[model samples]
Target: MQQEFLPQMSSATAFIDLSGLVNLFDFETKAAQAMSNLAYEYVVSGAADELTLRWNRQALDNLKLNQTVLTDVTKPDTRVTLFGHELLYPILIAPTAYHGIMHPEAELATARGASAASATYVVSSFTTTPLEKIADTATQPLWFQLYVRDDREFTKDLVQKAQALGFQALCVTVDTPVGGVRNREQRINFGLPADVVAPYMLAPGPQKNPLTWKDIEWLQSLVDIPVLVKGIMNPNDAELAIQAGVSGVIVSNHGGRNLDTVPATIEVLPYIAERINGRVPVLMDGGIRRGTDVVKAIALGAKAVLIGKPICYGLACAGAPGVARVLTILREELELAMILLGKASVPAIDRSVLWEKPDN
Candidate 1:
């Protein structure tokens, strides 16, 4: 009773005219028009009532920026360094599943686009393309997003494989023990097309086990590469992850796809960052649509921010070029935001950039 999602165009003819797309939302608008109903729903849908999904953007919108005047802002720097790798901008591509559903080149196209924009690309564990192939295509620093399986050996082997593949970091996702109740996808009976399968999943029997801090500790023991724990929203959990020896923490709510009614990642980011107290780097995702959002995240405490749906939308519109253009737009927007705020560098952003209402 499941419906399979497939795009109409072949990879060779997948290119769409991206001339009119000016921003991320423009890509979203175009992507919705270009993609099949099932594919678009899969990209945009969140869990249950989707309150958290809506709040992600709403909470960011509620935050007001306080700009300064009469400061020399001739040069604006958007560079950020994470785990020793310097990114041209603070924006990174969040790991998302089933890129093949959006475009024919799949993760290869995403990798090329991220590399073209000089941004870090995180490959999802549920990637349609093989990790080795993605690594081969990516010119920028690559990080592998891990969803630990019930089988400990399988999880261990996957970690080793990613390390061997030259992935710079292992981003272990710890939030999704079970799938979310996404009504939209459920309404469509969404299922992947036959040709699009996660190559790493071919070996594991089935992942039934939820990840634990102990598992994260074990993962750290396996390889010398830095292991980051993604899906952290609670401050206590962020503290625990650092104690467990994680190199970094990514504050996320699974893009509001895993749990409904949870606070937006942006809302909880400051608490997590405060708890970490600069002991380790903090990154966040969800509800980042503009350069101001990136600046807001940096000001609050995020070392960098990852974007999910926008990248998929870009891929759906015009393959690699669309993806690159999305990143470029965000970078330029962030640069402009920084210049207007009279902040010359990424590190110059702080709580002072935020406006607080006066008490009566």
Candidate 2:
């Protein structure tokens, strides 16, 4: 039997108190309470049966930490360097579209929050706010997440504009050639409100021509900034991305929103990392809910990790402060995890920190 869509309290009727929210899930709970059923489903639902979505979190939980004790636990470093910039933490805000649905301030508020947390903010091409406006609000480094438009001229122009607007790198999303079969959204008959629209999307329909490796080469030829391929799940694809002169690769299945039964990003990180062999930075997103997850990812071979829904929850609840709080909790938790693991810095984390089951 098919399950019916359940309606939640409207954002207008719900009130949020950010002070009481202690963790990512806390914010998620509040955000769900404070959003319309349409909005919440848009943010939370995964593709089809959401098998990959559930697995993304479960796989991270299945890995047991091999904690160390009796070491100098003082001054644990959580800093990491990527693309010539020193990030205070290995955590970054994964790009999600249409922030206006969550808050009136939209991506401007997100930029401010990411700056306050000193985290890199990756603005989506489908951003509600203008790229220039987001750049103006950001104090920290910014990266642009691009969805190549069918119109070649517009895509080229957008990349040039992002470079001119001070976006440090290009994260070209490759997994979503077409919209996914989002059952939850379909059940709810969800659509963005007329008032909220993606300003960068000048044309009206879905992209008819999906991007290819040649497009990666074309983008590289057009700009000097580092280009990263997002949505890499296979080891061979990761190698191909490296050979295509990508500066980095994000191991993502579009946050489990593209395909339903694919392996979680965490499950594939090691293989992808191995295939890349340190040629370029390997980052992953999907199912990062705790600091321990961050530790596990680094130990397994992720140079950094990105969070998508958590940031939306924050934005929905308290705007910039909400976003800042989310980053702060993750940062503090990461420090504590490092101290407990006896690893002083992000680079010190390796597979040794994971507990492997003995052969039967």
CA-lDDT, candidates in order: 0.88, 0.88
Checking candidate 1 for backbone clashes, the offending pairs are: none
| Model 1: per-residue Cα lDDT over 64-115, one tens digit each | 9998998999679788888888887899999999899998888988888888
TM-scores across all candidates?
0.94, 0.94
Tens-place lDDT digits, model 2, residues 115-189: 888889989888999998999889899999998878899889999999999999999999887778899988999
**Model 1 lDDT at residue 96:** 93
Q: What lDDT score goes with residue 228 in model 2?
A: 96
lDDT of 2 at 19: 61
What's the number of clashes in each of the models? 0, 0
Off by over 4 Å in 1: 1-15, 202-208
Give me the displacement of residue 191 in model 1, in angstroms.
0.9
